[model samples]
Target: MELSHEYLTENREYKDYKDFVANCKLTKPENFNFAYDIVDRYAELAPEKRALVWIDDFDDEKIFTFTDISRESKRAAAWLKSKGIKKGDTVMLVLRRRYEWWILMPALHRIGAIVIPATDQLLQSDFEYRTNAADVKMIISYDNPHVQTEIEKAKVNSPSVQYLVTVGPDREGWVSFHGEYEKCEADFPRPEGEEKTYNDDPMLLYFTSGTSGYPKMVLQDFTYPIGHIMTAKYWHGVVDDGLHLTIAETGWAKSTWGKLYGQWICGTALFVYDMNMLKPDKMLQMIAKYGLTTFCAPPTVYRFLVRQDLSKYDLSLCQRFSTAGEALNGEVFNKWFEKTGKKIYEGYGQTESTIICGNFKDYSEIRPGSMGLPNPLYDVEVLDPDGKPVPRGEIGELCIHVEKERPIGLLMGYHKNKELTDAAFEGGVYHTGDNVTQDEDGYVWFVGRKDDIIKSSGYRISPFEVESVLQKHPAVMECAVTGVEDPKRGMAVKASIVLSQDYVDRDPKEMEVEISTFARENTAMYKVPRIYEFLKELPKTISGKIRRIAIREKDNKKEDK
Candidate 1:
């Protein structure tokens, strides 16, 4: 089944990518609840149209039509409302890529409640921090033992979370999600008058994996999805009646950037793979198994993919491939191109915004490592320290100017943190905190992050947090953490340590393993250091500052054995 929706609302016509960016306009409706405006509309128009095709490790499959989604979400909404959940309340979802997430998220939007999508990998302390920070009222989670145990333990500190709803099988003190959904009424009526959601209503809340401090809460209005028209239609090269697979967790912002909004609006069937772990061979098999048409993932996935025997699978069904979350490495792009005869297109954006820059198909030529031109919907520029546009070939921060108006689909601001929100949106511009350089040809090359943040396996990590954990050891005097170049992870966290006098004489190999274990126990798996270097002293600049850049430069220049 195919659906028809124009790529643009205001400027509904464009000849090329250049024309789209220069003359783009958005038509924001007064009360634009995506759940009713898009999802239900699809159900009314094309009830039997496939919205999602889901698969799991057990080879269990589920396909949902627009009518099914519309029905299930209404029931889910009625069930949630009966639990005393109201508009403006925050509900956290840790469904772990389960099919239930698609239904439950729309349910929250229908009720005008703020939906917080969280990863299943979070520990007890992570649960405590996020729950308390957002004043989360209820938590709907997967039935995994680890998740249940962690939340049960975290509740002692999170007094505000009043409800615990578990999906898949009953737990002792939790509501069975499926049982309740089956019993709840399928008719959910819209709120009347002022109680109804508006275009500027905060519908989505995302916790950004910050590079330096604790994760910040990103608040997005209901119209955020409207900005991704270019992302799917032009940048990702998605077509109507096509199958699109974006390799991202349900928690991360990238999922919505590719999975939900733009793809559905373009009438493409979304593909979801619920994997216990990421395996390149298994993923390649799925592409052939399902005959996926368009695919997108982080560069790390491609790095591992290129190392596999791709000749065994038939990938001709795929018409386009894209990479985001980080810059595409030239080697991986070249290797994949040579093997599969497909060029990996690159795009750029952050948690606070949708696709800011991308090599939009039909507009710009693909430059292996460059982020394509700014999307016409956003006024993006490479600004130097003074906040002025930088000359070509010069490095600058990627900033989005909101002088005309706050771009549709951009985050409203950091929730409950006016200081941070003001600082980022200072001068009527949103700073992306990423550095890049552009050539005269208008292609932007990513230089690095302006702060000490690590991009590994598509997760943004804080160097400060990892270094703080390393310093907790009694045997450590001082330590510095930086990202080391890696083909698989984009960059691996490397720690150079100065052991205390008593621990200096200890066996180096034995100490290495001990420290590694210590790091794993104290920090998240993604933030743990992979490479350890024992140093008598860390390199310091004239101002007595640790030269972390020196460490990164040294690692980049190191010849692989």
Candidate 2:
């Protein structure tokens, strides 16, 4: 029996959520390693099974098999071992969607060495902070002029690094990874004695692409991927042999959410669009070309898709679509639905845990703008600051209560910051810094980032709620709502918008008044923006979340608003 079956005790096709969550139980085996038990197991059972279908920016295509990955990872593990990356040693791979990421990451896991998957887009300062923060001993990266220059610059300040490796080209002072793997033996034995790993051993660390403050290092145990079964099967609706695509860079936790872990475990062939930048036309072409059965991306991608001539694309084969990273706009949801007749499902979680809530099939009805139900594996609630459960109509912080049962995918801790970790896990509850309201039907509506809430004349406002209304206007493409410094209300509702291309030439004052009027008509009076700023683009984190703090800072320094 497979690991999924071993862990997922009964009811694979569960429909009623209350009954499904009530019976959901994972059987934890004593010493389970994903690379060996899952990856190699598939290689043994079905060696020729397709693992990855990759396309590059140049329109080049390549395919890989489970056998190829298993062999490559073993060889890579041996080569990494030869380079002195042993158990518990930290190795950061800056290989963005390059197929090498698939091989090297699992290879790191097989040897029990800690893996930190960073993006190739890191600057020198970013690299220095990550390397020193994680005590990374080795760095494997995609070789490019900028990336190469930054790594060399960071290495001067990053003294923990003992070896430098590159994947593509032969460079001086760097081990050519592909060249070394070819020469190394295809079999690597697991380290003996102290090298053995428990299911709870730290296997992965992700630096949260945060909006405010320094990035927090999120640590997840070896069993982390098991939790994403909820992500792939239930939320993404992935099927074996079908192609599934989730847009994410290797550095982010979303890659493991889509590309690796659950998709592979569920036997889905992952579609990787390894490109320098995202293009709406390119993604649509890939969908039609690959016959992608299931797909997930951030709402911004959907916003761009809705901008294109969507009617020209043939995407009938795609069974389900999902979005995360930020709240899905109601207008984007409605437009895509009108074009494709498919409602974009929403999921919510963070680097610290797997899918906490989602619009899973049959388990929850399609509530166009809702984040669906909490995953059956975890106990989710909206709690007040005092830790008491908030009423259905009220807004509160979203939290996962682990007192009764600590689910399989919860983060181990903040790697080295016990203070932040303890504060997050206070009262046996992990408080997600998201504000939300629960409806009578238990569907959760995202309000806004916890810190981005606006208090206007004693009326608390949700920026997300206001933006959802703004998105309904034809002129609005993407928008961010943040509180501006107000002398009377303490904070005033301000809208920073990126207008749709068609509306660009329109007069700014007219467009603003129209959008402002639209919001006033649709939402509560206090939620309407008192000030509107038109922009070419909104400032966003690498993960695609709007940098509201940046918007707020710019709003603060203004004298006569």
Candidate 3:
């Protein structure tokens, strides 16, 4: 089927991208399952089409056809059912980029269970919270002793967890997932009347990064996969039957953004790189080795990639580049563009929704730092404090208009927290809690989080602007900007910085002086950080977002002491 531009606007209230976004028509179906509608449908039509291309750090490689994935996932579904997993049961998957994540996810969908993709980097406390909050029934994890040890400790506090299934080598007291699958029939029958699942049935639950407090569960229904059609096909420009690589562990929401749902729905081969550690040079080498066609990663990864010389490897095969998770600075964006002649198309979305704003393929005009236009499918708008629409070019809260009803891509509300959900939609619009400004031409530029915006001496400042300036400095490697409590100014701009390794041996006071001087010259004097803390590393959430709240809290505690 040839996808038309109308597919992006099908059943939507808005005529085109120009209408002041309001009352979007959300698409719903009687029985909607991505595995059936997208994946399995493609499998039936093109059984031998390449579905996934996987490679590990050790250079091991494998390619799975749609038929292979369909068959293996059926066996996995049977195996999971035998282990007592059922509909609505939550299963935590801690496989980092393993091909098994692909098999197991579809398997969970086939069995009508909820899959919670989690990172193996979780500490015991993190594990405890997620397990308790979600009432996780089983944990399917890698056999790494370090992660296994944390799971063992978390089990003591999580009584609802009934099984530990290991993906790799056998671990004591843990069931071998591979071994169990080997015994199961490859052609297992689907559950009785399984085809009757509605579009609203919960298929996945993602725990927010918890930068503020304990993570909130974000539940997405079966139709969530349909929403990502714009994500991979339009925004990422994924090519059919070509490999697309998104640098994310299987745990994070970015995996869904790039790996399984959208890419498979587009008939593109998903690339999985199971690496033990992130080495920018090694990753580039792998891209060359595997002939990666399209790539997406966070700004953090791009920061590291730009530092390495580009002439050392062949990136000619890569056709499209995209970024999300956090704001991308103009410096890194320009550098990558200079090297590869490929502009990194910035996209904006949250754990709560699919790609809401992005630089689409048809939009040839690339703004260096803009987050592009609001996605055609979503009724997005910039609103002021009173929930009124703000004038164009004015900064305001980013909100999704859900007057017709929440879209399929949007979360079903904070799981079990109606109060929070109501608060989020109190103004009749789904407030994203992010502050941004729309240009006269309609491109949305990220300012900062509403809470992260610094109010100093009656002036509002975006931390991202300061961080963007700081990133241009040669001595700086990474930085997080936050507001520190100030009696005179209400709040003072503070920068917690990590210097490059070459500058580590330099005197701390001297390094601070250099950074402050660079900031003063590069940006407005009032925007420059008044207080600076040189650190070995900035605190980050599991998904790699710098936790400015943690830094603010630590600063506050020190003052109290």
lDDT of 1 by residue, 1-561 (tens): 332244355434467766776666667667878788778988998888889999999999999998899899999999999998989999999987899999998899999999999888788998999999999999999989898899989988999999999998999999899988789888987777766998888999998876445789999998888777778877888877788999877878888898888888778889999999888899999999899999999865776687689899899999999988755656567879999999998898877888888988756678777788887778878898888899998878888898788988788999999999998988879998888888998887776678656889998775655766776675766677899878899989999998867789999888899999999998899999999999998775321235677777777678454
- Model 2 weakest lDDT span, ten residues long: 1-10
Ranking by TM-score: 2, 3, 1
Q: What C-alpha lDDT do the candidate models reach, one value each?
A: 0.83, 0.87, 0.85
lDDT of 3: 0.85
As a whole number from 0 to 100, the lDDT of residue 62 in candidate 3 is 94
Clashes of 2: 0
Best by lDDT: 2
- In order of appearance, the predictions have TM-scores of 0.82, 0.97, 0.95
Error (Å) of candidate 2 at residue 298 is 0.6
TM-score of 3: 0.95
Best by TM-score: 2
Candidate 1: the clashing residue pairs are 21-376, 224-409
Which residue pairs in model 3 clash with each other? none
Better of 1 and 3 by TM-score: 3
